[model samples]
Target: MFAPFRPIIKDPALRLAAVLLVLFGAHAATMAPYVSALAIRVFGLSDSAYSAVLLVASVLSVSASVGLGILADQRANRRAIALGTSAMLIAGSGLVLAGDNAVVFVIANALILPLSASIFGQLFALSRLAASTHPERDRPAILSTLRALFALPWLMVLPIWAVVFDHGAPLTAIYPVTLTLGILIVALTLAFWPRDGATRWPDPKSGLTFRQSLREMANLPILSRVVALGTINGAVMLYLVVMGLVFAATPGRGASDTALYAGLLAGLEVPFMLALPVLVGRVSRTSLIWVGAALYALHLGLLPLLAPTPFVWLLTIPGAAGGAVVLTQPMAYLQDLLSNRPGAGASLMALQKLAGDAFSAAVFAIGTALAGYELAAAAGALLGVIGAGALWAMDRRAARS
Candidate 1:
């Protein structure tokens, strides 16, 4: 069980990536569950406006991710990229903290924060490159272990946020908390991030011109797989949004309940995440994702119907098992699709995020306009299955070709 982390434990570069990922996850754990609430309930953006902002943010995130990824390959300078994005995170939080309007919230979320989100893909990109030094067979396990470590902070941070919110911290308090995490991220990068030309880290330079690189990613095989996986993974995005909104809108439930619910589900997922490395060769990745999408769809489709009752707590079982697989597998899979282009491979994650966010935004808008949150969640569930099936078909077709 613990064997997966041996590589991370032994390698300083890998160790640095794991530590930084935890801190980054900490900020996300604190901020994400509440970001939707802040946009709509606190800042008074309409549902349509909020979805539009999320759509715009996805654009920024993908642009930063892909541009920096190719540039990272060109210069092999992940440390430089990490430091810059970390500062952007701080600036984003400060934007919201200093201003008190919906427009400011839009700028923070849509521009600064989304650009900063590129750090996430870059972090994995760094680790993937570093892990290349270890035995080839150990690579998947090493990545999975780091991913679990990323989720580990949520176990601790979300509960803390619950306590803080319970004790009457303002909803906007997440900005200052994120501000602190951002500063620590920058400090850590300066203190421990590997040098660009370090012997320990082998940068995979794509060598393609910028236009050529972009054209490669735009290829049908790569883009279609990303889109299919992104659509399937969109279920999680929808779940996150509805979890906060629907759970909060329930008659007796509120912020504390939302926090605890998200915390417990995320908590349950940690073990499964840790356990996934064990299944590395025993189960096919595609098979696992197929099952995961179905289970996740079950979790999402039931969420709105059951959120009002104690029965809702039972969701942790399926949500954790399914969420664990869906959340981590897609990343490793995407990275593999562009195996040699570690930086561009990492950008695939950002692209998946962009596609998922766009799908969720559209689903959320249409579902809510047509009916309500339940309909939105159901739409997410249905699409997850469809996307998963599409991916299976596409991959099988590609394999044959």
Candidate 2:
């Protein structure tokens, strides 16, 4: 069952992609979970402040990531990955040094988040590069592995922080280590990632005179729908994540409970990602998506009854299964589109990121303003319904066309 990963690494291009993915995961863990966890625990920030960080980071990161994507379109993957990773190393180092200054810390974190969006750079660049060297079905398998690799860092590193660092000491002390890791990642990416190659995809002219690639991507009909679906799903996903924490951290329940529930949801996702392709082969993508959507709806509806108990934890399983469906199938569909038009893949992927980021920020902002966790869950449920409707429409349209 798990043996395919062995062959995945033997293909040099895919292996390179997977390695870059792992490094990206390491970089992302620092900016995302590590930093946000620090802000919440050490700074004694309210849920609103933490939500704002995610929202602000999403906007800036998406904007920066799209710009980097255009640079990728015009240059070699190695140059793009090198430049982005270098930015992360600098930002990570800055975070390490700027420890006590709150303002500086936030600024550094914001900068660090966007730099980590370079992971998106690596994902898009390598996905395109891998497609050039391998068959189309390998794209989903590669993407699933790419996503699954992220779980290892979170599972391994995050719990360590939980165990060792009580308030935010671990985040502060570990900054230097993260910085060192950042430098190593940059060097490895620069050294081992594939460089200039035969025209696997058409290259646009260099020295872009300043036009938004996202606008161009949004203009494409298929890509536009994909971005729309992606945005809605992303927003709902963020709302679910944020509310779950809030519910777990309520007066009766503390941060430990929050952490436990969050960890459970996360743990389930990794294996789900690893197993996704096999499941995809056995079931239609449309069926998987609708089932996932329905499960999310059920999960959200149950939030009013949710409490900090092991029994409540079972609710997360269906939602987690739904999340796996949401996360994997869309990319597979998008990759198919990209295979038909390679030159557009990177930009389209970037647009999907931008749309998701923008909507996620909006959801976080709105949900944070609302006082009740139930309200947030209700909002998420609505978005899930909309996502399911869109998928249903698309599935019907595809059948007819």
Candidate 3:
């Protein structure tokens, strides 16, 4: 297990990037739940508040990510990360400040929460930067390892947040702690990974203008597919996430069993993602994607079989399989596609993020409005099948050519 950990970089900036990722990942897990806990326990909002929280989070994230992506194109990656981390600090603090005023909290969420994307989106920019600077073979491994770091949050912060919120802790109580943590992490990021000129990529001479980047990415075949896949997957994922309440409420399931089901799905993402580098390196992108699409279809197919009993635990295998496919290979495909055109790569990434946000929101809104939980599941099941068919069609087209 430890043998895979070899020294790839002795430089301070790269090391700092890794550390910043850990902190950001932790912040990501805690941020939503913190505000949510407050809304439920302190503000006395209804369960609809949870969906509202996700919608608000999605909006702020998409907006912030786009702005910061453009800023990243124009400014330093470290600077964006710093500003973003600073925003997370402020956002977390605002949750505490908003207290019981649900309306004020929602506004704060819209404005302040999106700034956290500065940190989240910066990681992608930084990875591209690192690949540009360092050796190529190491890039996938480096990215995969960083992604595995994301699982740490569920382990460290999520369980803790669940405990606090489970007992009905105030938003005031939770937000302050998360805010302090954000600030400390930001400080560490600055101290260890100081921003400098070289990190500021855009200049008059790079020839990578925003419009040119977007046009170039628009024409890239693989990036287009990746973005499309993300759009579909994101919508389905959001539908599932929102519909989880229904799954939990499915007749005989206890709250503990539901929590266990969710945890299994989260925990399964790491090892599969960790193995993606090796898998993508060995398999053709088309082949890997087709396999993934098939697995995703199977996973969603199995979901309906899950009941309130211990048998539901078996559903995690398909769930984890689907996550592995989404988290691992499409990224490597996008990175490979972007190698000759990093600017276009950045734009494609932004597009991917935006599409995911928009499509997920649309699905969630429509799914909820149509009916309650079971109907939503039926819709999600259709999406899974349809998405898989789309991928299969794309694969067949590629094969013919």
**How many clashing residue pairs appear in each of the predictions shown?**
0, 0, 0
TM-score for each predicted model, relative to the true structure: 0.97, 0.81, 0.80
Candidate 3: lDDT of 292? Answer: 62
Per-residue lDDT of candidate 2, residues 76-166 (tens digit):
4445545565566657566647666566666766656455664654565566666555666665666777667765565555455555544
Say which prediction, candidate 1 or candidate 2, comes out ahead on lDDT: 1
lDDT of 3: 0.57
Alpha-carbon shift of residue 38 in model 2 (angstroms): 3.7
Better of 2 and 3 by lDDT: 2
Residue 399 of model 3 has an lDDT of: 82
Off by over 4 Å in 3: 1-4, 8-11, 31-60, 75-82, 162-174, 199-205, 220-223, 235-240, 247-260, 293-307, 340-347, 388-392, 395-401
Would you list the clashing residue pairs of candidate 2?
A: none
Compared with the true structure, what per-residue lDDT tens digits does model 1 show for residues 1-401? Answer: 88887878889989989988999989888888898999999999999999999899999889999999989887788899989988888999989999978889999999889989989888898888888888898888888878888878878888888888889987898888899999999999999988878757566566899998888788888898899899876899998888889967899887887788888888888889888877868987877888889988998999999988899889878988988899899999998888888788888889888899999999999999999999999999999888888888877777789
Better of 1 and 3 by lDDT: 1
Error of 1 at 42 (Å): 0.8
